[model samples]
Target chain A: MKQFTVHTGTGVPLRRGNVDTDQIIPVRFLTHSSRTGHADALFADWRDDPSFVLNRPEHRGATILVAGTEFGTGSSREYAVWALQDYGFRCVIAPRFGDIFRENALMNGLLALVLPAAVVERLWDLVEDDPRVPITVDLERLRVRCAGVDEPFSLDEEIRARLLSGLDPVMETLGHHEEISDYERRRRPTLPTTTALLDGPLPA
Target chain B: MGSTLAQKIWEAHRVRRGGADDDLIYIDLHLIHEVNSPQAFAGLQARGLTVRRPDLTIATEDHNTPTIAVDRLIQDPAARRQTELLRENCARHGIPLFRLGDPRQGIVHVIGPELGLTRPGMTIVCCDSHTTTQGAFGSLALGIGTSQVEHVLATQTLVMRRMKDMSVTVTGELAEGVTAKDLVLALIAQIGTAGGQGHVVEYRGPAIRALSMESRMTLCNMTIEAGSRAGIVAPDDTTFAYMKDRPHMPQGAAWDGEVAYWRTLRSDDDATFDRETVIDGSRLTPYVSWGTNPGQSVPIEGSVPSPADFADPQERAAAEEALTYMDLKPGTPMRDISVDTVFLGSCTNSRIEDLRAAAEVLDGRRIADGVHMIIVPGSAEVRRQAVAEELDRVFTAAGADFRAAAGCSMCAALNEDRLRPGQRAASTSNRNFEGRQGKGSRTHLVSPAVAAATAVAGRLTAPSDL
Candidate 1:
């Protein structure tokens, strides 16, 4: 995980809503087990079209992605986040995001900011007008400096804290291993366990 | 106030309360497939952690595995590589895996319920969003990402924020020819794609209760399209009856006790939800998507709507974009639009019941000339069962290419089976997203019955239209 505070970058406006994970990185490209080298596959299909937003000359190397509502609206493929980051996007600004995609973004240290639709529209206008318009996403202040507007957005405190410190959630959950074991022991016997169905624990 | 089905299950699985809204919840079942889980396994090795509950975890080679050529070899090198990694990871972790040659191999969601592993009052997690399919059994099933997948593999628990509850109750009865697929499509259209975001939606009411277990699974499977992480149905006689003779069901007293506990997994009448929606089941018709997102749909009898008809600016823009990409003209009757292909597979509607529905429509009639139809079952067992019932004969006789292999075939376009560029399809899959079937491929999501009917007519239509 990469710790983050404030970052300034140009923006690329992806002018479509419900931009799904399948599009961000099509399922066809997801063959190997490895996660790296996905930058070339970002928007694999749309990138070929001359009129597509990302293919435009000016938006290349842009680190901020201003997308429509319901941006990453489908699939739980974390590869989509990797694809965005692989394309050098450190932050994604959308009105809303798919629940799983949003979590993936934050866990990987890519800032996912949810601004009002109106605010997003204004930023899109600014970015479309000038692709070099520097947008500042301040994780510490919980505000975005874009389109000459400083607007506050809300994020869960723990997620913000984790991002600032570059903490891994797995380590945090491991800290409560005792509680997890106790819960497992106290779980109702009726609940189906693989061991119950398979007749003893599987050997690792 | 009494707790809803989701609340009771969440409470049962709560490992510990954190200072934040997030709580650690124990996962009773963890499912993995080839596509989204490889990275998680690699992460586990890097972190020097072993799987804490290999006994509770399961894996299947589904998504990346091609749905053609079973015994010979995996034709695609990339898919073969991915499947090989899954086998290695599962073998190292000691997790049970159902391989391509195994009869049990299938889409993770389809086989979970088929093998009777999915039970009421359980918490299930998978890296795939459609894991909600198991929620039809009253479990609190959710989709997690790779990071969470690795965390669960290592610790068997997830630190997560609680989801708000939303109830989407269906009153009245499903009219003749109206299937769960149609009802769900109508639901998404009514509530938009983001309707169920941040909430666990419970599908209840007399209409839902009347649906078969398979149909209930179909309904719950598409919950992700409505932006919900999970969708659940209360356990009832329908659920129990479906579980009765399955391989994993407990015997004698254990079964009775499990049934008794399952019966109690329903929301109290007085319990309130953060959001509520009601659908008149009688009004639902065969629905299909005309846009890139699942929410952008219309009834089969309706025409493609104009973007100008949208009240929201974003929605209007989306409709415009969809119409351009889909190559659909406003005011053009949906039935009048023709398609070149018909895909009858995906976790959403690839169950035995879906195959039967399509078979029934294709029983004595051949698909239209030049209209290619491919029928892939949800699992090898499903395909075997369909063959026993001679549904495969019906499909093949009707000029459809009925496949013996079972996995996600044309749904995500991960395999060799896909629509050619500029080709349109009436598919029973959950998504109609841009380039889902293939690059420059246009998709119209339909029910199995409607898909069959469309194949017959070479256009989008209902079964009764024939």
Candidate 2:
């Protein structure tokens, strides 16, 4: 995971809600290796449509995705966030996010900012009216600031700490090896014995 | 204070609490598949780590393996390499593997329950999101990332934050033609997909209690769709009966002791949760997706809702956009929607019971003209069971395509099976995102009976319509 503070770029106003991971990076794109070539695959089907906000050249290099409530609601694929990040999105501002997807994005260092529906609507309208309108998301302050509005948001504290420190939860857990080992030694006897119960009874 | 099932299980499994955020909880079962294990195994090798308890870990080739021919797997070199790597890793670590040719080879989620490996009060983790399916038996199951998989491989424990408890209670009985699939779909539609965030949901009430083990698994499988960490049903006689005489289940004297422990896994009547929602299941009809997401759904008899009715203007706009993309007219009854394809088989609804339900609906019917239908079993065992019951003949005679087994086939189009562009499909799978079935292809999530009826009618129709 990369450790870099978020600086929200121009928001791309997508009026759609419940944008699933499948649409972000279709299953076809998942067949390939998980290298850095997936930026093109981000919203592959939608990019072809002339009406899509991201398809417009005016919104090129946009870093903030302002969408409606219940954003990122399907499949628990972390690649959706990866694709958004690779496509230069710094923050996803929505009324709400799918729980697993939010966890995935936050842990992988992508910022998912949730605001009130009214506030999100304002951002959506402002960005839609002018595609070049900028929104600033300061990771340090955990706040989003647009032309007329400024409000604070909160992310899972554990996720925020992990992202800031560039620490993987698994690796961080293993850092205390001595404590884990000692606990295992102390609890060994009471722990259930392993058996190939699929094969037959345990050997006495 | 009264203990909830989650707290009881968590407390029982805790190795130690090292810090404010560090609670080392031991895991009893670790399931792995080809898609996510290679990276974790690679990470382990890089760190010179050996699997702490190889016996506790099990690996299988499911996601990437071609379902048609066991011998023809090498045709796809990339997929072949993944399976080969899984085999090599399991062999190197002395961990047991149930590969493609093995009778035990099936979807990781299906095999775990069928073989009695998933038990009450166990802590189960897998690399796949549907790991919550195991929670049906009163376990605390969840999906973790590759790095966490490697950590579990080396230490047999996971450090995790506890989740708040939320209970969704359903009373009354399911109406005829409604299955567990419909119930879960209705739940998501009502909850809007993110309603259960930051919580562990326990399914309660008489309606949930009446379901079979397979039905319970189907319900828990979609808990992730509702943004819940897991959904559990308290253990009862049905759970024990399902586990009896299975491969890994305790027997003889140990069985009595295990049952005594399992009996205590339920919540006390007075136990409290952080939040609770109640639904009357008797009123729910067969449900289907009408828009892009699972939450964007309606009962079969209801019309597509107009975006203008939305309380949030942004949400209203999104609904309008989804309506445009799906080519659905607001206020149009969902039953009037026509479909060009029908798919029956996914982790969500592809067990033996699902097949039997569809077969019952398709026994003497013929698929409508120009409408394509396909049935891909969830696992080899499910396929074998269907064939033994002659359910495949029922499907084939009904003018439906009976294909060999595969994962994510039509459910995701990850393999060769996909709808042509502009085709509308009635799918017994999860997710109906834009272009999810194929480029420009429209999808409506449905139950097997509904899929079969829609195949015969060439439109979205209820099983009773047949």
Candidate 3:
């Protein structure tokens, strides 16, 4: 995982609210084993519409996505976060995000910053006014610097630490292997082990 | 202080509490499938780690396998490769896998419960969002991403954040023609798709308790559509009876002991939740989605909502976009909406009960002209039961396709079954998101009963409408 810190980039205003995982990267794109090459399929359906802002030349090479509330609203597919990252977005600013999507984004080193809806609206306006204007998302400072507003944001402390240290949670979790084993042993012995269960025909 | 069902389960599974933010919860079971596991296995290999609890983890082929032509090779190279990777990874890791041709092969959510792997007071995690379906057994089932899947594969533990509890009390009896699908749709429509975010919703009250175990699973499955990662219903006689005689469930004395434990899994009389809401089941009609999202819904007897009805600007804008995308007009009668296809299976409503419900409605009626209906069972077990009951002949006689394909068929459109562009469907699957069924395809979420009636009427209808 890449270490997330202060980064400045052009903002692409995805002004739609309740943008779901299906819209981010359709389920068809999820067929492959490899995670790369998702950028081509990002917003696959909407990109075909000439009026969609992401298709416009002005938003090309944008690294910051300013979206409305409830971004990544449906599905727990991490491909949504991967698609955004592969499409050159290092950070996404939204008033709110679906809980699972936020976790997935953070785990992938994609910064998900929550600001007030009013602040998000301002960022969208600023980006729309000048797509070339650099927007700074500072995970270290928990603030976004853009369009003359130094907006404060909040992220879960442990997630912030994980992002800063570039630590894979699996390693941290393994530290408690003894505890996990103990719990496993303490669980009721009545439950059948996966191996003990028959893969036979259903009972009558 | 009396503990709620969720709290009791959480306490039972907690390895340790990690400050104010998170807890170290041990997962009793971890499920994986083709689409999500390949990358997780690759991640493990890259880290030079083997699976920690192969005995507790299970894999199945879903999402990418062809529902039809099970005997033939998978036609899509990408899908086939993905499925093959799952086989290779599971083989190499010594994880138990129900492969494509296996009699036990099915959707991860369906097989887990049918095999009795999902029991009361357990904590379950899977890569698929609909994993919440297992929570109906009074387990703390949650959906995790690929990264978390790798975490569980390595440690079988998740650093979880405790969710606030929201009690959704459904009062009164379900009106005639209203199914669990209708109740859930009404909940989502009432609370909006994001309403259950940051909370674990426990379905309670007389109406919820009255539902069958299969129906409870249907309700729990759609909880994710409400932005909740998990949902639960307290274990009772219904859950225990359903688990009995399953191939995986414990036998004899162990079963009695487990049942005794499960009986204690309910909320106490004075247990309080962080939030509570009441839904009148008697007032719920057969609901259906009329827009690009699940929240954009109205009763079958209702009309398309005008954007002006929304107070939020963003909501109003979304409604406008949905109207345009769905090709619907304000005040248009929802029952008058016609469909080109009727899909009667998904994790949300593909169990035997759902199949029986649809078959009951389609026993003798023929699907209307130009309207094709397909019924895909949730699992091989369900398919076997449907065939034993001769539901296939009834469906085929009524011009509905009766494919006993045991994977996600039209739900995610990762398989051979998919909707064509500009086609409209009345589907039982969750998530009516744009392009969910297929590119340019419009989906109206409905129950199996409504789906069957719609197929015969060539329009959105309920048995009551008939």
Candidate 4:
């Protein structure tokens, strides 16, 4: 994954609240084995309207998504984050996000920024009023700026470090192999393992 | 301060504390299914990494498998290929798998506990969100994403930021006809869908303690809908008895030692929580969601709420849009909502007890003239037990399609079974989001008994209404 320090792009506003992962990329489109080729699957159902925010010509190249509260509220699908990234979105500004979605986003290097609802509402007004408004989201500075409104955002300290440096968590955890091995050894005799022979004598 | 149950499990699993950012937590069990593991395996292969502890991991073919007669080869090329990939990955990595036709095969959450692989004070992780269901055993069961899945596959540990603790104490006893599903739905409606955000909720107090193991699973399973990654109930005699006969449990003196430790898995009397909420379980009725999300539900006796009734503009907008998509009229009695389809199976409510509860309601009477009902058990083991108990005969005799193959079925709509445009349903599944069952499909979340009753009445009817 590439590091994310600062991103500059115009914004599109999706005013609907509780935009769940099921709506982000419906379950029907999750059949492919590979994770790529999901750009069109983002809001595939809603895009049929031709007037939906993502479909509007003015927001075509927008990389920031300003959605209402409780965005990405269902399913633990990583494809939801993949969809946003494939569709060229670098950041999503919402008042709140589902716990798992935010975790997925941070892991995959997509910036799921949470600002106050009032700030997000103002962002919608600014972006909707003028589509050409350029927004800058700086992960290092933890700030988001749009016309007249420059507000600070907060991320979990650990998450901020991962995104700023683009760390591979797996590789990081693998570095502490000795610690894991020690923990495994010290686990209680009562702690069962799937490898134990079925109905076998318990560890003593 | 004394530790809560979640804190105890967290502390036990901690491999090392890393600065102020996160901790390295060892994963006790990693459950994999077809939908999410393919990409993770591919990533592992790309990195020249191998599964560190294949013995501690298990795989199943559930999410997209068909629920038709006795395991016909999956016809959908994509779904079939996904299942095939899982088999190949597990084979190459020496991981054990329960395939589609395996008698032990079922939804990941349902099978883990049945096999005695999910134990108290352990940490469980899966690629699916409903993994919270296993927390009924006093474990910390968390749902993770595919990237995290690959991390755990390569190294049996997950790095974590600290989570706040929450207590949802359900006081008093549940009413006679009410079920665990009803109690959870009522709680979600009281606290919005994102109410439990960033916290691991521990269910306690009298009502929760009185529930059976299956009932506890049913309650914890849907905690994800409220934005909590996990929910847990402390280990008690009920949990011990349920684990005793399961396949992987320790035996003889070892069992005694395990139970003694499990008894200490509860929150200390002086434990403190970041937040707490109390619910009167006796006041809850059968709940049915009228809108898109799980939070937009009302009791069977209540009327649909008007969007204008909301104090916040965001909430009012959400309600208005949900009403539009649901095609429901405000002030209409919830019992009067119509449905052409009724589905009764999911990780949330497809255990043997859930099936029996629905079976009792559908024993003699048939579903209404035009209503279509599908009864798919959570697993093949569950299906076999239902058949042994003759629950299949009851379901089929009641005009419902009792399926032989056991998998996710219409719960996620990854198979041939799904709703078409403009169709409505009363589903016993966890989510009622738009297009969840199928495109343009509208769902009303209900319990098994209510699903059976609604099928008979062709509307959202409760067992009491019958």
* TM-score, first chain, each model: 0.93, 0.85, 0.94, 0.94
- Tens digit of per-residue lDDT, candidate 4, span A22-97: 9999998788788788999999999899889999999989999999889988889999999999999999989999
Superposed by TM-score, candidate 3 places the C-alpha of residue B342 at a distance from the truth, in angstroms, of: 0.4
What level of docking quality does candidate 4 show?
medium
State iRMS for model 4.
Answer: 3.2
The regions of model 2 sitting more than 4 angstroms off are A5-11, A55-59, A122-136, A145-149, A182-204, B16-23, B74-81
Q: List the residue pairs that clash in candidate 2.
A: none
Measured by TM-score, how close is model 1 to the native structure? 0.97
lDDT of each: 0.89, 0.80, 0.89, 0.90
- C-alpha DockQ for predicted model 1: 0.55
What does candidate 4's lDDT look like per residue over B127-236, in tens digits? 99999999999999989999999999998999877888999999999998899999999999988898999889999999998999999999999998888868999999
Kindly give the stretch of ten consecutive residues in candidate 1 chain B with the minimal lDDT sum.
B64-73
TM-score of each: 0.97, 0.91, 0.98, 0.98
Candidate 1: clashing residue pairs, number: 0
Q: Alpha carbon lDDT of residue A100, candidate 1? A: 93
Q: Residue-pair clashes per candidate, as listed?
A: 0, 0, 0, 0
